[model samples]
Target: MSQLKEIIYNCKKATSLIERKEIGRLTLRESVELKIHLAFCSVCRIFRRQSITINSMVKMLFNDAQQRQTKLDDTFKKSLQERIEDKLNKNGKKL
Candidate 1:
């Protein structure tokens, strides 16, 4: 049928739906269309797999960065603040 052909042959729409599904749930129509397209399209299937892998890797990197975040010591912070205030005072900026 023409509808089936349309659903299975639109690689551009299929890829867009794949990315959209990654960020949020697709509508029932979009979900069905994407599933149909992916089933028939090997390139699109490979693209979807690569997209999922890249997303997972990026999420892991961000989580690791957040977990290892550090802050300046209180002494260092105070010293930096004092230096900033001194510069502002010298520049005639009220704080």
Candidate 2:
């Protein structure tokens, strides 16, 4: 039974690799193990469902950000530029 328990735990860890891979964030060993584990685990099947839901949420958040525009108006941008230039001048840095 302990062996079955360890297999279940490893399967959960492996499902995380699906998201990690999407973000360019997995080691080669992790990638291979996740593939191997997924091949045999039913729990990993449920984990994939949860992973897809979370990934969809992330995609929606990014889409919302892309649809929104910065509230910084022209005057604000100008003020920011002036502040940066002032700081650079004070430090004797060429702008």
Candidate 3:
């Protein structure tokens, strides 16, 4: 039926909105349509939850790493340059 088809469409749209949380509020028609679709669709519900969980975990991990610096400092850089120059001079290279 046309009404059933409309319900399915709304449900898919709502799942997408829930994933992004950008849909403020649905009209009465949209609310009814989404409810009907979600009532029978378990996969969409699970997907929305899992996406949230994974996003949160990744954000936390990134925040922790952001507090640490992994690169060498100026002294280390100078030491590396000296080693390279010494090796090059020993080989009679201009660089």
Which predicted model would earn the best TM-score?
Answer: 1
* Candidate 3 error regions (>4 Å): 9-12, 22-32, 73-95
Top candidate when judged by lDDT against the true structure: 1
- How would you encode candidate 1's per-residue C-alpha lDDT over 1-91 as one tens digit per residue? 6999988888999999999999998999999999889889999999999999999999999999899987879999999999998899899
> For candidate 1, what is the TM-score?
0.71
Which rank order by lDDT, best down to worst? 1, 2, 3
Overall local distance difference test of candidate 1? 0.93
lDDT string for model 3 (48-74, tens) is: 678788888888989888878577798
Instruction: Return the TM-score for candidate 3, rounded to 2 decimals.
Output: 0.51
* Number of the candidate with higher TM-score, 1 or 3: 1
| CA RMSD (A), model 1 | 4.5
Off by over 4 Å in 2: 1-9, 65-95
Deviation in angstroms for 15 in model 1?
0.5
